[model samples]
Target: MSDRNDNKPQTPWAKNLAIWAMIVLALIVGVSLVSGQNSGSDGTVIAYSDFIEKVDEGAVESVEIQGQELNGNMTNGQAFVTYAPDDPGLVSRLEEKGVTFNAQPAEGRSLMGAILIQMVPLLLLVGIWIFFMRQMQNGAGKGAMGFGKSRAKMLTEKSGRVTFDDVAGIDEAREELQEIVDFLKDPSKFARLGGRIPKGALLVGSPGTGKTLLARAIAGEAEVPFFSISGSDFVEMFVGVGASRVRDMFEQAKKSAPCIIFIDEIDAVGRSRGAGLGGGNDEREQTLNQLLVEMDGFDANEGIIIIAATNRPDVLDPALLRPGRFDRQVVVPRPDIEGREKILEVHMKKVPLAPDVIARTIARGTPGFSGADLANLVNEAALLAARQGKKLVGMAQFEEAKDKVMMGSERKSMVMTEDEKKMTAYHEAGHALVSIYEAASDPIHKATIIPRGRALGMVMRLPERDEYSYHRDKMHANLAVAMGGRVAEEIIFGYDKVSSGASSDIQYATSLARNMVTQWGMSDKVGPVMLTENQQEVFLGQQISQQKNVSESTAQLIDAEVKRIVEGGLARAKEVLTGHEDQLHALAGALLEYETLSGDEIKILLDGGDINRTDGPKPRTIGPATGASAIPKAGTRAGRSDGEPDGAVPEGA
Candidate 1:
């Protein structure tokens, strides 16, 4: 079932080796023949004197040569004749010393060979047309090609098994789509009261928040035919093909009315016109134009609602989002903590997970995780447990799986010299210490020097369970936590060198700082004014919004405020770690040996070496006092005895 669904529409492209061999042979033969023919006949070839004699007269009706007719062209002042005489022995009889012959005209056979030579080009043109037709036919034969491809996967009542029950996150989006479901189930309920179904609803969101899932749910709950296609399907190499495809798709949709047309990534086609990105006449523009015409022009009674999903709503054309086209844009953003917990619960229900595996704990650990990430996390845990022949996925596995999803799998084998290893250990230690000590900060989970994905080291922190709202102090604490790594390195080693492993950390911290000044209005100098516009490109091949409505002094002030916030966090981190220098050295030394140490292990050292440090790879060893909540322990370097693979927690995954 999975295989069939994966390769749906059944566009079978079985290559015939014999046929390809024949095509290659034909191409080689054609090339050779054409090359030789071109050499033989570049232009008209005529006998110089013979053709000139005929040109003196007007359109020589016939040539009378010694009272006999002749035929040729008068090109280049010559008439070349291709006539072989009737008698085989005539060539010997024609060369008498003093005899001279003159020509006048010929009858039916005049210029026949020359005409055939001119027809060669026409023959080649016909051959080219035939080849193109064959190619088009071949494509058409394989699952409807040459014409526009409607990627719309159709689902009937029986096929669409997914319903709102299957979707866990996105309460707001679910409510909006439920109305559509209500309308589809009973159209006349609204019609009887003199109301019309919305012509279209644009589902807008960041990727993987279950927009497509909701569309399917509607198809399931409404029990109507659903046609799913992507916006990219409309674009084609040939001009006007996209427009034609748009018309064809609508025509089909109209016939399959009372259905849903779910378009994934509409921004691919419905981008703003004259953006000069693809000049106005590109295939996307044409498709978008046709779509606009169809959407507004269609009767509301058609009941063929359109749902589009995209991460970037700003790039979409205004026409497509306007009143008559898409009546509402349903936002399916990253789920909050409760939504995430529900999502996690749904994904884990089928897996052999331990009863103690707290979904809320996992959800809080993943601050920005989407539905897709949660799904992947469940799979990862299951896979990890299965590989180790475990009965159930424990919290340890889930924590590791979460890290695998966010930071990528741990790079346990990344060999580092003693000096580099120590630096990274101290760096991550700084972050962990800051988060642990900060009043507004979330709990720390794990601090590691082990290479994971792109970073040489990392500090993982877990927010409070079911925490949705963000306070300014908490945001500042998070940024400060991010800056602590660099600060630790700078404070001890002097501000000589810093690796860009902290690039993501820096960008995130800077954005938060600026947002506080501008968007969040948490700054003193900025005075509660929103200034998200102050964002600017900080690195290569990046786009950042310009800092708006300020002067040089204000810019300096904003920079100072950001520096002050980060510095305060770093100073706090320094104070915490420095005050406990003996513990810091002890932790870094252990990191030097193992390249990674769990929060419990660090805490055991912090708490004067009280706990059993030798109890290897276990679950949730850190309690409320440890402050390592945000760290993903399941995908941690210590858990599962392997790195995170594919950011997906696979069952036995």
Candidate 2:
């Protein structure tokens, strides 16, 4: 049944041609009827006096009268027509002249002409109605009467098919889904061992973690029919429409048994019922209820494996997460070092990479990059190489691409005063100095005074390896590093002359300090208890019903603790900069000269060594002393205090 429906031919052209032919026929018939009426009078015209004179002279053979008009045949057999004035003696005159005449009624329409004239309007109306109905039926799986039909599309293997080999960096998720594919390919193999086929699998992860890609890979590997749809496709403004769509979708799936149904971003329709204020949405709740039944209802949906992807599994309904509905929950997390290296290799296959480009090194530099981010990085590198008119993407291009993705594109065209440049140099140098001097902080990756994105200057740090959890000493070191810019400005330019470049720096430091005190329980006074309230959505009923966890006294204590943490970091930064003023000045001067410097260059400059930059900055390998970190750029513009750029900060920066 499904195959026949899929193979059905569309006859829009034929239908339109038929309608046009009918209209043309109707027009021809109408034209012929009008022309026939006009051509009915084929005789020559004669004056009334001439016609009467002919009748009196006995020259007329016969005459026919209709109202005031008369038609007669002369003795010569010629036809003539004439109009007569009101003459009551015409009949007697005709009789005396020996002319035969008769009275006749006026001509009326023929039966066929009348029927054609009436039916033309009805036929035109019917044709127009059918055209509109077909148009509705052909649009986005919708029809004039099929408003509740499912919009799920059956994905074919011919359209950019992705196999398991194409998916990288998410081995665990792939392995879990592979079993389902195996069962789909040979269900009897699993059945021999008393194994039951899993009903569904849920792919949960952060955005860009390759959840949807993995789902597609499963379909490709299994070589089965794939039906793909979004959760939003099941929902509509009208009530009960979503429920009907769910039923229709499952019916289609049943026809193609042993197929996969992939639903991306299922959170849109599977959110918990009665969760938000005003008792939640009735229509959405009903839709979710229907979906729940369809997944693991009384009647089994055998041979049909459901695959769904969502980043927000926390909001999904509890019933949907049970064992029978979604038998497996696959977590596709961001790739670590090895996984990133593999992912980079996968994307680099399409690009012409130079001999100097090493995937492992680039992967180490990008510690927490996802599969999608790695692909973007490779693409950006290729674009950079293309812009420079290079035939191959080299290590230098990859380095620059990584920097652009991690921070932002350099704003070299932005005009800055000489004084602002010097200040920005000093500010960035301070951050580098603190990161270098502090033992617990990550190593400085690079320092630059060039304007990038919204920042006037920025100093970056990278971990020796991927650091999942931060230690207390590391957090304290990070706090000092964050305060480095402001502390440098206060010491060099004095408190009254300090600029607003430290606004983002202060915001970042304050947020870190608060999280440490209220959330992390790093504060001695706050202890291990969480004093901060869980942030809920504004529309959620719990947000309105719940009160703050902290009292007035506790709130004050938290504020004081956050302030103390920030000030301690400031004092530490001041102490470090005060002791190493000469090195700070040296690093700042190098930044002003080169506009940018790597960690090795900064180290060389601090040690009173000159860099030979005639060949450009040399590529440095990631080592124990080399790493990367994201720091918000300081704003230099006057009367603009809020310095945070839109989407400038990276995740966990």
Best by lDDT: 2
Local distance difference test values of all predictions, in order = 0.64, 0.78
TM-scores for every candidate against the unseen true structure: 0.64, 0.75
Local error of candidate 1 at residue 462 (angstroms): 1.0
Tell how far residue 42 is off in model 1, in angstroms.
Answer: 57
On residues 536-617, what C-alpha lDDT tens digit does candidate 2 reach at each position?
3566444554466677788888899999999999999999999999988888778777877888888888888997787765
Q: Give per-residue CA lDDT, model 1, range 66-164, as digits (tens).
A: 213233333233433433334443223333221134444443433554565556566656666555555665522223345664546676545637888
Of candidate 2, the 10-residue stretch with the lowest lDDT total is 620-629
Clashes of 2: 4
Look at candidate 2 and tell me the lDDT of residue 30: 78
For candidate 1, report its TM-score: 0.64
Q: What is the lDDT of residue 446 in candidate 1?
A: 69
User: What is residue 342's positional error in candidate 2, in angstroms?
Assistant: 3.1
